[model samples]
Target: NVYYADFDKILLEVCVGKNRLKTERTDIYTNIRHFGRTTKKGYSFKAVIPVDKINGRDKIYFEYTYGEAKVRTSITFLSFQSRLSNKLPESYWIFGNSILSYDEKKKQMIVEPLTFGSHLKHEIKMMYRVARHGRKRIGKKKTLEMLRLRASIKLNRGFGRKDNDSISGAPKNKKPVWITYDQLFKGGDNGQYFYEYMNKNVSDIETCYIINKDTKEYKELTRKYDRKTVLPFSTYKTRLKCLKSDMLFATRIDIRLYMGFTENDEIYVRDLFKADVVCLQHGLTIQKIAQYQNKFYDNTKHYFCVSPKEVENITKPIYGYTNDMITLTGAPRYDGLVGEPKKQILITPTWRRNVTAGTNEKGKQHEYSVNFKRTTYYQIYNSLINDKRLIAAAKKTGYRIVYLVHPILSPQADDFDKNDFVDIVPGVKANYEKMLKESALMVTDYSGIQFDFAYMRRPLVYFHPAELPPQYAEEDTGFGPICRTNDELIDELIKAMQSDCRLEDSYKDNINNFFPYDDQSACKRVYEAALKITNFS
Candidate 1:
């Protein structure tokens, strides 16, 4: 007998020598019953063969097929117990050279095939389970174990250091310290802008920033402030400051950014840390993200939002946040968006999971598929940028086109063909605020950056080459004209250029309804909300 498992179905084959046998006996027991039809295609089939006909020369194959579209899949077996009427085998077994383990929660045997690299095999298998069953079903213990495993993986990837240090170096009798950062290795987002605002307007609280000392952003920051204000990331001193701080602010709530890189470091920060966490989001909430659910942010004290609609989205049953937990304070980076407009068109598209090869524990894509140039995302943008009509129109209208690749897709920046009419910029080096202020028109596909351009009363064109996830499929994105083809996007670009990128009144009304504040006081509001949350006002 041979067994095989695929993404949608399972197959079992019984053979005698070179001949195959078929039977109508469909009753077979496996641990899959514990899931109770978790998959869409839950039905199974089997064939029975006489045991006397089987021989040692006959071969049986037990295989698991993984699809490129699906990141993870698994097969499991179970040992016989009184709970199952003692009809099954007493010992667990696997036929292939795969990682085998026991799932105590479901009382089943788990097997993970070594089809990919072995850098973080166990951790990757755990991620597959979390994706399949979700965090709530997996319980808190498994989730914490996953975090710890992820932390060790990240340390090997140079995201942090493995150092032991004390908090004795921290300031002893200074004011309450508040640490802020956008990314562990980068800056220039809501976190940086809010930290700047805190330093300029308020003096009661001490502000510090954590950034990678090896980055260009760090060199730029050091020229403005002393070392105490700009602490190096993943170092003992930074960890000390984080431990001594009273409050922590960030655009992302990742534990790796605030805690040391080790197995138990994330558990310590999440369960034992005393500092209050305030999430200054990098972008407005425009889609349903599974990671943003309530259980993932158990330590977050305040969640700053951009509008009432965003607040409503967070308070939904899926997100599980209460009204009191949210604050309707606009993004801090919006306060610094002040500059003259130029006749330039910015085309920025978000990354897709299907096209990316894999991401690190911090949700940063460090690799891209070898066939990335063959993906639809690449073909569409590549064709649009190189279109003869679009290139001629930009040249004739005295307009420049800039393509900004999302940071996660930066490794493939060279995949697209370059021409004189268009300039390609990597997201890591892009001056986001500068581009937002200078660009007169913006073209995007499901990027939250569209709101930033809309805040400037500029025109926007959306390109939809693929269907969005189910959560965002029903979202009403009527703030701009959505284009479905390369020709349609080119036509919209020419039309916007003809009118000097003036936003339509209907879209203007949409933008107005989306954002309640544009008075450059969002940083102040966010600061006040943080002070209130920490009871430091």
Candidate 2:
């Protein structure tokens, strides 16, 4: 029997001595109740072989008939008697570039990946479409009690188990530290700086970077740091390193890194390894962000706080951080923001949670509504950038509008007008320090980059299209000139640019009270803290 990825048109053909004989459809497979339905989850087709009637010269074929195109591949059938005759190894029956295995617990045949998309490169990546196409919730409905039972069963799987040395092959060192960026992609903020500090500056410690296999940094880091260890994301080896290392550092709270597999996985790892988790925060805290709510777990021992007010107002009270766990190290990303300003006005706005709230026919989640132009937030922000008043103001003032969009809306940036006066900066390609330094004024709304601009003594104009969300409204955003209407935003931009973008007195006060470090020693302090082991348990 063979299993392929999900497709509507699949047939199994049996050939005896080069003569066309019989064809089988997988939908009729009912030896197992879930066989017909498993194809929706990327496992398609099953072939029942009549091996007794076939000779050594006979062949079996699988055909995928899609639209007008037919893709056919054949494999020579060795024999079915290998299991009964005991003359051949388990590798006798291999098909379609995949290993066939049976799941004893599920009572079904299991193909390792169940998909061929994993083998393709980036240019021809079709795995995402195949897995997500025609996806719908399946299986029998269950009551709340049944769901609870399943959860309890999963929680109790490896509870209180003895330490397993499955991942104990990590290098022998006095201090082993693991560092990673958000989602294990690449470093941009404090995570980047600290990873570099330990990877290059510190010689006594062993540094390992956790990276997603698809990330560009994965190959680069692996090639550069040949002497040190580099763990690929979502592997047992990486999980073991997280569990055994003296400390773990990352940009955000990733619960999957600790207890994703089982509830006791975190307990076993934290207790056995005494691994302290440090959060080198991605940005400054101003609003009541959802990601920061009750983020501290048992193993989360230290948080790199940027300011005292952030700890006093947001981090300590709302985010559940104690004074001992808070380390007031100004963000290392800001160390590069100290430079001259160019005649460029940057327009950056926060993302609306509701804009990306619709679903497609296949029940797959997608952001950006078809009626996005109707939303007040979209209309106001979009109109402002393309507004003749703002563009003309920039042209007359001898300034260019360098629009640095949020990474979420980056792909759609070109959807707006592209004039010589307005340049759309790609978020990934742009050098953050140089862009920030070149911009004389920042036009924003509740984005942390506003703070970055204010900290650098550049003028900022807050443009609020409608009544701000209560979570963001409640927080103080310093003393930048705010614009509630389109006209007001335009007036403020022209006024700031005309006056050469001077910093307001109240903004200076906010800056003085916000960041603790002014000597550019943030990286040094964060690197020093990375070496110490804090046992939160």
| Candidate lDDT values, in order | 0.64, 0.54
How well is each residue in 115-149 modelled by candidate 1, as lDDT tens digits?
Answer: 32432454344445444443564457655554544
Model 1 CA deviation exceeding 4 Å by range: 1-174, 256-258, 268-272, 361-365, 467-474
Clashing pairs in 1: none
Compared with the true structure, model 2 gives a TM-score of 0.61
Model 1: lDDT equals 0.64
Model 1, 163: alpha-carbon shift in Å? 34
RMSD in Å for all candidates: 16.5, 19.4
Tens digit of per-residue lDDT, candidate 2, span 349-372: 776665545432111123445565
